[model samples]
Target chain A: MSLILAAESLAEIINSYAECDASSVAIAAVIHVALIGAFFGLPAGIFIWAERKVSARIQDRLGPTRVGGRFGWLQAVADGAKLVQKEDLCPKDADKPLFRIAPYVVVIASFAAFMFLPFTDGWSAVSLDVGMFLLFAMLSLEVIGVILAGYASGSKWALFGGMREAAQMVSYEIPMSICALIPIVMAGTLNLNEVIHYQSADWIGVIPPFLHWNVFHPVAGPAFIVYFVCATASCKRAPFDLAEAESELVAGFLTEYSGMRWSFFFLAEYASMFLVSAVAAILFLGGWDDGFGIVRALKGNSTNVLDPGVIAGNLLGAGVLMLKASKLVLIQIWVRWTLPRLRIDQVMTTCLKYLLPMSCALFLAAVVYPMALVLGTGRPQILPLSNDVSAEAEMSTSSEVEVERAAADGEVT
Target chain B: MTIDQYLFALFALLTCGGAISVVICQNVVRMAFSLIISLASISALFFLLSADFVGATQLMVYVGGTIVLLIFGVMLTSSSALLQIRTSPAEGFLAAGIGVLFLSVFSFTVWSVDWDRNEAKLAGVTAVDVPPQDYNEASSGNTVRPLAMSFVGLRPDKAGKAPGYLLPFEIVSVHLLVVLIGAAYLARTKRRVSAES
Candidate 1:
């Protein structure tokens, strides 16, 4: 579709020609990781300027009115240069190796979150069925990096900040996941595209189902609300932003960081903030689809701009997903400015006391709601893609088949 | 040998080598780092074997969650101590000998496996395209659903084959709940109990 594909194929060819799978896979992984790195680095550059401008405006000030252009757009770029020029500091008493490595841990954990995230249908690097769970898993890991960063800094302030974060993040993760699960269960599948498609062509009252499309399905309606709240918390947006609440802990766990190392944590924070919003979009808001059904309608048409051949439908799907994810990311940034930060104990109380039970109830309700759909409708409401998988259960359990088949084959080793 | 086989060997060697290094390394921090490598390589091995879900779980839970906890604990406990806690040379040698013997026996059993026709079919997709996702949670095809369902007291996947781990799942959950509570209580600040000193 673009010059990128040509360049990518060329690189893949070069990568595949490497002497072994170890080297080949390693090369490919490096390229993939480099692209992600570029994504993080470039975005941080632009978003930093945007954040400064946005935050300044909220506080009624002229943000960055000096350097780059009419609006101080070059301020972030200038800041990057300054950070690069600054000396890297690790206290004499700081754990040497851990201090050196903590930033990379944060970066890696955030990057790994991309693994199970689907850009489009069947277009993921690894199309995992448990993409939902894996996203949570990787994201939960960000706490570890934060804690380690705090601890390895060897300052009393750093230790306090890190320990507090370790407790807060781990506690919040439970309620956050449980809340997020509400929408997922409503969708019946954890595959990002499937969840979005459920919203893509929703029918409504007035215009014979064509004009009155709604993304909000009854089952997923409340769940989306829940999902947004959970996503905000998961991203550590305002009201839940205790990890580095500036006034309280003197930037909390980020107190000791400066220069490029400090920037890594900020980059990770924003990237993860973007990532959570994107997940919310995919799960609850009907990813990539404009809810007009136009994209879905034009998907298979050959001459349509939406269908440019060679997995164009999938590409469009990816476009829709990314578009939605981007929009949601902007919303997260907006929310960050509008709300005041919550106190630490209050944050934990809101999660453990209030959100936790509500999420559990929603999960239970969603699970049985599907069963009711089956019974009331005289068929499963959700279209069964393949009945063979279900019928196979009647034939024999899968393990029996596996054991019998494995026993039959001579080259299983 | 196929690239797959070589990849398997490479990852296996990494896992074993890293694990051994973990045991041998006297520096506690380095030992934790080596454990991370070993566990990570084992996850890679799981991926190679087409256990993608399990591999991811390994990364998420073991490497990400547990390793972080262990490292944090290590750092906290080693606050005033040197970077490492050294064992006596005699103790180390005895442990190494026991470990070597156990590894040899394990390897011998593994090498002796009869990879029959059925067995080959069961786990033969070394580099195949992802299998069509059929919704047979009762079957091993869908690892995520069955695993989750198994935690909630069902063994649809292994219903006919082996004992359902329903009891174990409940026990683990309760155990986790208790541990969390206990940890919180233990870590909470309290007034000094003694004025005698």
Candidate 2:
């Protein structure tokens, strides 16, 4: 825990000192990007192992059960070794620059998106007021790189994969953005912290507080469901993953890539899947609030709403949010193994015809629901900062001492 | 001669110089790239002026949005064989000479401007006058709300300046809608007729 908090404090101090100049600011950006890269890189390795096990379970067979352990936890590392050792090949007809550059482009875009992301209130490396918009915009930049990767690859299979990605990510972005806006409108702010807190607000209902959580609001309820579906598509999983319908296109846009380069895409995929889920978790689910109302009931001697412990609180919040996000990502992996990919046209039609309209309707209902509350109660009945998980982020730059102490502990280790 | 003033001068020079080069560039992709450099320098200038929100928006829209889209169009239309559209050398030299003359005149204007930073201190903008609150010290305080309010019909913050851009904002929104539709229609892939037949 101290190790994690140390990184948090280091990031803050590093951010404060270096953010004034292009050179040092860029250095700070690199640190943030490095952490993002590590998060995605490590998780992608684990997901590969998870996918094999999940796929095997779906097929009613043991997957690498004899390797590493009963669950074959080391299976991905072993496969990675095999992939790295295997021949790296590019066809004679392939476009060398695009083929070599594709994976890095994808990885870079996703990493850039992290700079604007708020882990806790004030935990962001770069917090623009339009942080959410900027985050989405950066995420959208990934599609262009993917499209270029496809077009420049000079192969029919690669071209098809790229086109499918261009079509899928671009189309799905609409519904996803609309669904994202549902919470945005409902919260009345595009500031991610404000939106997350607005979603965290505890309702006026009596009885079970857990029941009065996000699951109970008619508008938030539907928006939650809509955002989930759109998120699944945005992450390009299972039914929406027509871009990589492997049986048909032979690994989609990734057909030419191999070794470490190939793995970056998967890492990006899983991390982004987790990222979108975390966004949903922040915007709809009570972020780190534990919707069960347990953690809040436990805080001692602090209406300060923010404190020295708040960074830990947010780290804990992010951890809880991460758990929920990983659960969703796991469900995606589960679905991928169980369900077959949709046809390319069907994927497009589903996005434009169905998901888009449903999200728009939910957005309208959520918007009117809040307005209606104000009319009925003479004052808005919306829950206050209870949902704003980052509101709990205590900006106590006091965590530096703990870092030195943690360094001592690590040296002892 | 503060660092802000120095940085502002560097970025302003970069923006104007890059933008002029963009106008002269024959290759669409190169032009797009030049425009991006110009937009970026302008955004840097905005940041130096303390317009943080505006600077970020400029980056998000101009550098990342407009320039990317422009490059995408160029990429789509341009085959590898024709990396550039060549203008006559005579034309190029003439344009260069004219551009240099224009640049000199622009530079002269740039050297003479006495852009004031409100030394007299305008009253009624209480938010700016108030001594740094603890939270304000922590941030530059989230600029999203102030920018948004300025876009709508409100003057709670900059009461002295013209009220929110109720009309211009709406017009821009409508203009954006039209541009979006026109771009999609124009850029849509059309079925090519067989020219040989």
Best by lDDT: 1
Report RMSD for candidate 2. Answer: 9.9
The per-residue C-alpha lDDT of model 2 at residue B74 equals: 67
Interface RMSD of each: 10.6, 17.7
List runs of model 1 lying over 4 Å from the truth: A1-35, A202-215, A301-319, A371-413, B1-10, B25-30, B68-79, B82-84, B108-142, B145-197
> What is candidate 1's lDDT per residue for A1-413, written digit by digit as tens?
11012123334566666645345554555676666566556656666787888888888987899886689989878987889999998789887787878888888888778765666644444445666876787787787777778777878778777777777777667766776676666555565555554445533333222221112445556656666676677666676777677776787777878889988887887788767766777776666655555555556335433345536566666676667766776666777888888788887788778777777777787678768887997654444323222223423535754554454342333
State the fnat of model 1.
0.20
Cα lDDT tens digits, model 2, B30-87, are 5665676688788767655555567667866676566666765665677767867788
Model 2, position B165, has a per-residue lDDT of: 73
Tens digit per residue, CA lDDT, model 2, A1-413: 11012134444566586664444434554676677666666767777788888889889998878768678898878877877786767767665655676677677767766665556645665555566776776677677567656765667787778778876877777778777787676556676765655444343344334443454667777777777777788777887887788889987787777777777777777777767877777677755666654445444336444565554566666677667767877888887777777888888888889988898887787777767887987544444434434333421212432343354345445
Give the CA lDDT, 0 to 100, for residue B121 in model 2.
44
Point out the worst 10-residue segment of candidate 1 chain A by lDDT. Answer: A1-10
DockQ of each candidate, alpha-carbon based = 0.23, 0.19
TM-score of chain B of each: 0.72, 0.71
